[model samples]
Target: MKIFNCAQFVRNLSIPTLKFYVAQHQLCPDLMIDWSQPEKNIPKALFSDIRRLEAVQADELTSLEKKQSITLGLVRWQDDLKRTFCMANDSAINEFRHALACDPEATVVFGAGSPEDIALWVLVYREKVFRDAELHLAFQAKTHGKYWKQHLIPKGLDITHDQARLDKFCEEVAQIYQKVGAGKSSHVEVTERAQDGSVQVTIYVEGPLTVIAHFEKNQFNRLSTRIALETALVYHPSNGIVESVVKGGAKNHTAVLELFGKHIVGQEITPDVVEKKEFRLNALRDEMLEPVLDWSKHGVHKVRLRRAKFTPVGRAGVSFQIDVPPDMDKPDAMEEAKENLRVRHYFDAEYAMESATLIVYMSPAQDGKAEHFSFGIQRLGASTIKNLSSKNQAIAYEVLKALDIIDVLDGPGNPVAEEQPESVS
Candidate 1:
């Protein structure tokens, strides 16, 4: 059958995604963890177990083509692999979340899983979940041609009976599209009306993982259409990943006929929204222009504010500049670890809490084996983080005032006075 529509594309792509992973030697056959789960507290023993199968680099996904199943596997997580058994799982996601709760400025957390196995999956978790689920439903449905005839229109072209409907839909999609950013980091947005009066959205994103998916503006009765529409969504802010259609600008999706329903346009350049879809279009377009982009592959440990001078206008941005030291390539694992921690201390000591402004001060090095330094800003993406604790907020506000990121609008909000060194270092 000639496949044409976005739904057909998603349905075709996702139906066999799981069977693809079955061929890989399991790290732990006792466990049945999927792409949705975080890889934390994973056993150290799995390193050798995983390394023997395929050289799964950090955040790497290997897909072996199969006639029936889409065989795929995420490789081992990177860093401290030889020494640490506590790699990935629920514990790590939670532990990191808690630390950020206590110290929003803790710089140790954000860069925890640069190229971990779960990194690729978690980065695109939402994209996979809904698409996988929808494709599963499409695989299940065997609709009668009459249903397609009723929906396909005045001319008797039953959509479910032939591939022409898909072709027509795909053509319609090509003519109306928008992109917020350019490159691998950019998100391709498309919106279309279905025969059942529901609007669907297709977002194509290329990263360490490739996600091309579609969904409803909002949930509609499944009986209304055989396609399975999602009723829930989970948004993860790590690196500003957008998790739902509404988050992608699908407000009032059920209303239909809304032009440019999904666009990457965003107004808030505030630190909090910078990673979001709207703002990402402006800042990270070219970064994602490729098929694979990640820390292990790119040499960028993290993206954080290195230096900024605030003004009434938008915030200034500089490279956070974290890197492996030139000498870190030493064969001595212990020595390498010590060097990693030394780099960590340099930045973590200054911005102890994980706040939006907390810099990921890796002190950009020429390059080496040094483990990257992280400040747990990713935890702030938790929906639970409503506002900074009064104390931390005050602290952050003071620091922002010092940096002049924000003006001292009132009493006590003023930048705290600091004593200067007797002489320059």
Candidate 2:
């Protein structure tokens, strides 16, 4: 038997919200007290101190005070929950209670330590509760099929056809903006436009700037999209094509073209082809001009640059990674890369082993936290400087200087400064 734990159900429910459930279900709850009427339900003898909440601000109350109030208030809820569930219909009540437990609303209430937290919690709780209610209705529809699909489903009016309703709704929306000091709205237009076997919605806004926006048809449904994809590959992994679109512009045209040619040229673009294709292989490479020059300028020709990728590291920084088969596939690749990369690699093989292959990260130093750049620069020196030779160290230092992580000395004989950390990274 699936035992219904009614005591557990009412433990964290908002009392005022519970009233909606009670009235809707026709429940005769006894001990539970609503948030608004805490005094009405609880006895005068019980929670005498909590009853003084009327004089004190709930949001400003101390932690101990809130704990005392909630602890006493829960006592009443425990008694009421048992009584309410005992009288309520077994199946329906249990389902609703299960939904409440599963919802994020109750989870947030327990997680909240203060009134400010509870305020945000309530907003989240209410949103999730509405969604949970919709889910419950869906469950009800499975058993009550015919009635659920017909009578229970109220027909909604089309916005374009119902001018009066649309006007009234727009007026209310405008009033809401005015009431909240969001300024007045001019008007709302909902006209449909047909172009190239596709429907485009025209939303005309007569406001401060008279702005207009558009939403295109779903790609698969549009004629132009279909025609453009006519020679598209036999649905091999679409990641490359998708990535090309994401990257955009003329720069990625060759990669996009090659990717499509490799995948599509002679193959099908059906659903089954898409399902059968594998996307485990590496993405097509693009040799960037900037990093190629950086490598040439570095003058470290021993470790041949196999492939290079420069990715945006943080808000305002770039991470340049170069893969050298010689640097990686060696028996002591890590040791070799580290020793050759940093001037200090000879003194610390462990540092070389840790920093090798990861290369350098060029991140913007936070204001007043530029001091930490020394540590990051030290890490790069461990991983980035390939050789202790005069020319090689100069090249590595040049790269580090450009990133603003370290200062460049006038000559190669000048020693690099020691690092310091003052704040959290």
RMSD of each: 21.5, 25.4
- Candidate 1 off by > 4 Å: 1-173, 177-202, 205-398, 408-425
Lowest lDDT 10-residue stretch of candidate 2: 227-236
lDDT of 1: 0.26
Question: What's the lDDT for residue 289 in model 2?
Answer: 11
Per-residue C-alpha lDDT of model 1 across residues 1-425, encoded as one tens digit per residue? 13233222222222122223222323334234343433332222233344444443222464433211211332232222211222223333332333234443333423443322322222233233223323222211211111110011111111121234333433333333323222232223232112112222333332122233444334442232122122211112222212223212332222111222212111212111112101111121121112222222323443333211111112243323222332322222122223343342333222222222232222355684433322112211211111223333334333333333333452122111110111110
The CA-based lDDT of model 2 is what? 0.30
Off by over 4 Å in 2: 1-159, 196-282, 286-309, 312-316, 319-425
- Give per-residue lDDT, candidate 1, residue 135: 28
Clashing pairs in 2: 233-264, 234-268, 340-386, 340-387, 341-385, 341-386, 342-385
